[model samples]
Target chain A: MSRPRLTFLESSLPYAVNAARLIVMDRGMFVADFFLATTVPFLMQFLIWSYLYQGSSISRSFGVLSLSQTLFYYAFSIAFGRLNNGYDVVSNLSLNVREGTLEPHLLRPVPYPLQKLADFMGGGVVYSVPIILVLAVFVFIPPVALNSFFWPGWVLLVVVSQILCFTLSWTVAMMSLWLVRTDFALSLLTTSAAFFGGELLPPYLWPEWLRPLMSYNPFRFMISAPAQAIVTMDGGFVMTALAWTSFYAIAFGCLSAFLWRQGMKRYRGAGG
Target chain B: MKKYLLFFRLGLAVELAYPVDFIGYVFTTLFVHLTRFLFLNGVFDLTSTLEGWTRRDVMVAFIFSVLLSSVVDSFTPSIRTFVRYAHTGRLEPYLVQPLDARWVMIARWIRPGSLFIFAIIAPIAMLTLSNLNVHPTLLQAVGGLFALVIGAIVNIAVMATWSLTTLVSKRDLPTEFIFRQVMRLNQLPPSLFGYKALTALVIFLPIVLTSTVPAMVVARGEYFLLAPMLGAAVLVMILFMISFRMTMRVFDGSGG
Candidate 1:
């Protein structure tokens, strides 16, 4: 057997270190995030659901799952919340735009959006690991087993859906060109996602009148669909989830591309 | 006090200058609150109570959380400003001034957007109280006001600690992000947390001191909590003083 050469991609190294440094350098922040992002949200959800399920037998099976499955579903839902932090590209790009660093980068040979996306993915990989580890704890503590037949597809859907989520977030960030202050938009997006995206609770549990509309929303696909698919392991559900995610990914990608072009066209640098 | 009022007036003017942005922000905040209320309502729909909190209790908690956060947010500087000052060594200018550096920072950053929120939420909170006929007694009102004062102090002290972190770190420390996350606890009832978590929120983070205690005082006439809540707030202020002092010791102006 031939030994393969170990090669590190030099271009990608900085963002990896950047990501690692983000978590490692700030011990206080890491600890805070571990609790606030992972531990507390899960605890909050678990407690709420526990109280919610108490003495209520009407929804005996929580969205096509038994009691044990329902516990895992909610656990996984909380896990999905942590996983969503990987998309920091939006905030980073908006900051860069505001600080005027983006002006210099406009003339670079590589597309600014693509480069930012790559840098973001680099950080995403590093930032997301601990969250996944936290998720693993929740997955095991309750010992919710996945559906073997559908687990593989569900995993695929999650990966793809995450990319779609990133794209949608990035598109929102590009709007900072006009908005200048993206804080309100970002806050709205996050708040909307938490509520409508099924992060706080499943859309299945939201008001019935709103369910049909929420089911079509991209934010729901961002968390609920993948989370449910992994647990439910329904083939048809998995396929639909993939289809909706792809639709969003493509839609958001085009929107981002268009926005980037428009922002570039409008760019007047400090010296310009 | 005159300086603060002058700065606050200046802050108000700056806020009102951007009419469109300000209106947009207020609307967005209202939308966010509406969604949260809906989510809370949805949760209650599943169960009559959450962690022993009735819908009214939770709604009141949510309102008070918004009020307290708005009170803090109205004065607190954005994390970006902290990063900018730290990076550019602008702290020197503030430091050299006759006034306190922290006060200077606060003077410049009184968020009008947040002030608007206070205007909106305060009325809603009172209306909700009256609608539920909470009709806080004279003692309850006084106790709740006392809680608010101490809670605001604790809030400022805690934010000051976060702001002072810029003295040591070159980059923004996610102080604001972590703060927003921690403040979410304010919207939740104390019963949602167990003993350990409750203790952490009460003594360490003091999120419960911000909204829950005050809301309870008014809503349930729980004036007995005044002493303990005030004590916790004082402890937090002292802790913040120590943290700020220590942070100053390691501070190298813009050298980080």
Candidate 2:
């Protein structure tokens, strides 16, 4: 059809890229912009932590760790935000089905999943600029302690966690097919992961009782496990987390793929 | 209101269509809430009371802030209302509309999916409040709901006040971006802020009234009845009036 036809499958991918780029370049979400607004509060936080804890880094571990963790967070979050393989794509594609546009995607030249990923990464590092800046400020400062764990372990954890998060999220996104609603599924992941995965705050900060539960949860492996390994230099359970992460990523990825194929077989052309 | 209903229905369809996004949004909200919890946890460990509230009280206040604010911000018009519309030059269309544009703008946000934000945490907040053993009478419930209404008013006013800067600023984007960060203040416990900051928040900004007062009413026991609660609503209304005047001037390109 000579392509770029404004067809459902073709149109959404470009739109996604444009949208991501728009959000990033969006003057409101700028790097300098975030820094300007955040400086006072961050400084306030920094001052509060630095003064109270003074030489005792242990007191404000999250704040102290952020000195290094923040940088990694900024870099990883920005790059990884694009690499997110699920979330919006799942939501959008799911919408395409409900809206009766799924059939067009099935007709496309590109593999739909790959197309979604391409669209996501199109804007590249733009959306992450703010995070990047936040990280950069922390770059000059040393991480609280990095002597204990090897960099490779930290790297492996980061890579694995990202994989795990992406894999699980991708699987979770497929729920849109059979279900009338997917919000519950999404909420469940986000809430658990936010704490357990270490996105909202570090898992270490969670109460001791909560920590054990979080340690076993895949959520921690995705964000905090690697992050803590890098910043705290603790690798005691890094391998364990990585193993679980790998298991979930592969398991969930296969499950999602199977479900999608099966669902596609039952797919009636829209308005069903 | 009818216009709002129509827009709300439209929004519902759009939201329902992308149910998967509900999860992503939930995740982001979860992340933000966790961030606050950790902050409070650390601060509490460091020192007992930031101002007058205990560590438990502060935690309750934070959860209240996030839960209620999530409802107000998401369901109400403009998810990040001020910046999204103000920057897109989208606010202009609203001004020309015949109905109460501000009301329309505020009420335009209807994310039924956002309902999950409240549902997931409501039990938790209540459970925590129960654990704290602070009980409010039926009158307190009315008063707390009243505080939420005030919170809605204050949120709208704050958005509008930021809208005033949206009018004249050389860089509208920067203004919105700045306001976005300013929006973060709502997520925090007001008592942690100093008097000037707290007063500014309670009076000029009105952020304190959103979460703190209601939480106080519920968790603060008998004092909820007597503390200067009406002042926050009155203050926000006044700010709205002032910002509305500025908006008019800005609309004419005089101030903006």
Clashing pairs in 2: A186-B23, A190-B27, A197-A219, B77-B106, B77-B109, B167-B256, B168-B256
What shift in Å separates residue B27 of candidate 1 from its native position after superposition? 1.2
Q: Which ten residues in a row have the lowest lDDT in candidate 2 chain A?
A: A76-85
Candidate 1, residues B43-92, lDDT tens digits: the string is: 77766766667888777767777777677777665434644576566657
Candidate 2, residues A1-272, lDDT tens digits: the string is 58454665565567457756665655553554445454433434443444444455345455445453554543343233323324555556656766677777667766676565556545433544543454455444653433445657655665565556656776776766776355456545544554455543445555667677766676666655654554445666667767887887788778878877987777675543
Candidate 2: tens digits of C-alpha lDDT, residues B58-147: 776686677776776464335335335554566666667787755654556556556667888888877877787766788877777677
The candidate maximizing DockQ is 1
Model 1 complex DockQ against the native: 0.49
Clashes of each: 0, 7
- Share of real interface contacts recovered by each model? 0.42, 0.20
Q: List lDDT for all candidates, in order.
A: 0.69, 0.58
